[model samples]
Target: MVRQERAIRTRRAVVEAAAAVFAERGYTAATIAEILERAGVTKGALYFHFDSKEALARGVINAQISDDYWVPRELKLQEWVDIGMTLAHRIPKEVILLAGIRLSADIQGRSLFGSAWPAWTQLVTDKLVEAKARGEVLPHVTPRETAECFLGAWIGTQFMSEVVSDWTDLNDRISVLYNHVLPAIATPAALIRLDTAPDRGARVVEEVERQQRESPVPTEA
Candidate 1:
């Protein structure tokens, strides 16, 4: 059990190191040596988990969407809003998320490793579908199409923020985006009830963290 736990930690270290390097240098320029230095792990250890840089990049992309820290809302559309807002909050501070965003944007290395857009689109679509079933959205709203469009807007907004303010203003931009996008799809009742506050992501994250801090871990058997 100890050995398995160590392996898991080692793998996470390697993935996080690779994410940092990729976020800073892009995939083509990033090297295993830098990753090893960052991870404080051996070459053999990295190779054991990922045979090549492509594999490492794939691992980073895969790790982008995980058991994310979340706080659920009663409203499904609010839940959807929470998803975007949380991502907007984390992307600026989390190297893994930033690495995924950067890797997906780079056309040079994009074909070597596919982007996370499809997965994100699916996540958004699923939420929208739920919201629609709950009558939160307009009857004419299509979940998948709306998800795709929302993702496109999100990516564009992220890029613009990155260029303009190094993502210092991403939360506000994302909030603005939700406000504009929601009106078209959300029902009048839902729109009126939703919270698109720029600070929501931070609040949600804090609540989740507080829960984690208060939760008890299992005792050794």
Candidate 2:
């Protein structure tokens, strides 16, 4: 049991190290030697935890998936949407690594979810479908398409923020998403509540800043 626990910790260390290094340097340029150094583990130890660098990269991506999305929150549609937007704020660094562009350059056997993206997307899509049925979404929009659009905008915004860190503030970006972007897709009834619909926006921003101070950077391995 002790050995199992230690192995879990070691694996986590490697993933967290990869996230930081990949975010810093990117996948194509990052190497096993660098990852091993960052992880403070020997190459043999890393191989013990993971079969190869490719497997380690998958671990990093898997860790992000485990961190990012969840269905058990059992939140209402708008609540789910808000949570999704809030978490989207954390995606840029993770996305770069997941795309195999920064840290997982050699990882190519499967997609991020390993045959489960559609399942996950369906879970989110279901919530949007419910929202639309309740007239929370605009009447003209289809639920699946609307969900895709919502995700696209969030991802695009995150990517742009990653590239032009100075041009965008995460807080301001989410506010714009809520006050401006959401209104475009929301029904008038939903739009009306934007003024006072429980400000998780502030909470999300505060959490990001808090994580920045406490963690200093991403750490998932």
Q: Which one wins on TM-score?
A: 1
Alpha carbon deviation, residue 61, candidate 1 (Å): 0.7
| Model 1, span 100-192: residue lDDT tens | 998988888878888888899999899999999999999999999999999999999999999999999999999999999999999899898
The reply for model 1, stretches above 4 Å from the true place, is 216-221
Alpha-carbon RMSD of each model: 1.5, 6.2
Worst 10 residues of 1 by lDDT: 212-221
Give stretches of model 2 more than 4 Å off: 67-75, 88-123, 133-135, 166-168, 194-221
Candidate 2 pairs with clashing backbones:
12-221, 13-221, 16-221, 26-102, 27-102, 27-103
Q: Which ten residues in a row have the lowest lDDT in candidate 2?
A: 96-105
Cα displacement (Å) at residue 195, model 1? 1.0
Highest lDDT: which candidate?
A: 1
**Superposition error at 74 for model 2 (Å):** 8.8
Task: Put down candidate 2 lDDT per residue, 63-121, tens digits, no spaces.
Answer: 65443333233324556555555454444435433343333223343443142234335
